[model samples]
Target: MSDHELRKAAHDLDVTVWVGKGGIDPVVDEASDQLKERDLIKVKFLRAARAGTSVEALTEELAERTNATVIETRGNTGVLHR
Candidate 1:
């Protein structure tokens, strides 16, 4: 799908993964596993996980680790696609 289509598709997706104080480390495996089962997944970065980092940065790092692309990020939520 195109970026616009991905964004539109992500609009209705419920957050399936959450990053908290533990940050991305704890969720990398889960995100990768989910990507294996689905084309896209939504992730929410809690306030604790945002400390000293922007959602874009966090999303990039998580995507890199999971071998996924960042479909989009709104507020603290991000959508990822493999």
Candidate 2:
């Protein structure tokens, strides 16, 4: 999806879902499951994630597991799609 669509969906989601620090594999799976129930998934950053982790790193990790699209990240919050 395009960045505009991602941003709009994130705002529409309203309710935030925490993916926690399950690493990228489980988080990606969780995101996918959420997408099955909801067309878009908002992945909120949790305290479990190390400060060393970068958004780029997280995006690449998820890309390998699912077809979810990285929509946006405003502060600790982010949006994704399946």
Residue-wise C-alpha lDDT for candidate 1, range 5-80, written one tens digit per residue:
9899889888999999999999999999999999999999999999999999999999999999998989999999
Compared with the true structure, all predictions reach lDDT values of: 0.95, 0.65
Candidate 2 Cα deviation (angstroms), residue 17:
3.5
Of candidate 1, the 10-residue stretch with the lowest lDDT total is 6-15
The list of candidate 1 runs beyond 4 A from truth reads none
| lDDT (Cα) of model 2 | 0.65
Q: Estimate each model's TM-score.
A: 0.97, 0.70
